[model samples]
Target: MQREGRRDSWEEEIKENSSAVERVLKLVEEDAVVLFSKSGCCISVAAKALLSTLGAHPTVHQLDKEKEGEEMEGALLTMLAAPPAVPAVFIGGKLVGGMEQLMSCHITGSLLPLLKEAGALWF
Candidate 1:
């Protein structure tokens, strides 16, 4: 009975987490700007800071090194085929490389225009 209870609890936890992940994925897929980032990475931090500075509240998907299994890695690889790296930015479902590219866009004042083009900005 105790074993069955534990299994039920674990199943519930899994279901809850799966639902959360699905929700996040749905938001990412639908959003104009989404970032797949690792928390402690410098580039990730920089990318987030830039977005914040621009007043762009991008949807961030935090990838856990330990929790993201082979399937997650494969999906990321498939999604971002070239110059594979963390802090991958997606604009309108298109992969936009890493922090450096983001910074370049910001510096060139193209970021806002791109966001506007994607119909992502309210201001």
Candidate 2:
């Protein structure tokens, strides 16, 4: 049986994670394209480069540099149901998945339309 104190602590953790999720949601909404990333993460670097190359100006949050970065990253993974990874991309407030998914979209020729629809691209 779990002690009352233990249960309370668990609940607190959930609340904290939820709050982080909320912050991420707000940040994602602030731009047409947002990338939740870690500054030193190679995958994140690749993701940013890919978006830039495609002429999409993505607003990137280097979670590792934020106050609750690790927590926010964990919350994003949970909220988006994405793999545990940095460089989670959102297009017009919609989860666009990570690098692999983004590359797939680009290869399939669907990324440009999404960028344009999100107003990240004009032409």
Candidate 3:
């Protein structure tokens, strides 16, 4: 976590307005649910599976496989201001966070509403 007023690595990255960040911003709007994850990450896979089961059919972008993945990863680091981990999930063109946040919404019965509002689900 970043200190209250101290600067961090992501500060500069976010300022540069890199193409990767631009791409991510575009992707989030293109789909109701966008998941930025790694193929080898089990939690990412599980999150994807869970959304699939819920009929969300989220758009997935794997950082480990793309040509611009490294750049995107850096962008994700800044986008996820909290813990800054993988499996960044965006819903309705909004950042809904990682697996834990997703599960929290699901467990709390709010996931369905989000999905429906995002047009990723009908029921």
How many pairs collide in each candidate, listed in order? 0, 0, 0
lDDT of 1 by residue, 1-123 (tens): 986886676566445456444544565678888887766877887787887677777777677743553334345544444345477787776666677788888888889988777767878
lDDT of 3 by residue, 25-81 (tens): 998999999999887899999999999999999889998888888888888877786
TM-scores, one per candidate: 0.64, 0.83, 0.86
* Model 3 alpha-carbon miss at residue 61, Å: 0.8
The 10 consecutive residues of candidate 3 with the worst lDDT sum are 1-10
What C-alpha lDDT values do all the predictions have? Answer: 0.67, 0.84, 0.86
Local distance difference test, candidate 2: 0.84
Question: Which digits, one per residue and each the tens of the lDDT, describe model 2 over residues 52-75?
Answer: 998997998998899989888877
In candidate 2, which residue pairs get closer than 3 Å at backbone N, Cα or C atoms, i.e. clash? none
**Per-prediction CA RMSD (Å):** 11.8, 5.8, 2.4
Candidate 1: worst-modelled 10 consecutive residues by lDDT: 69-78
lDDT at 60, model 2:
88
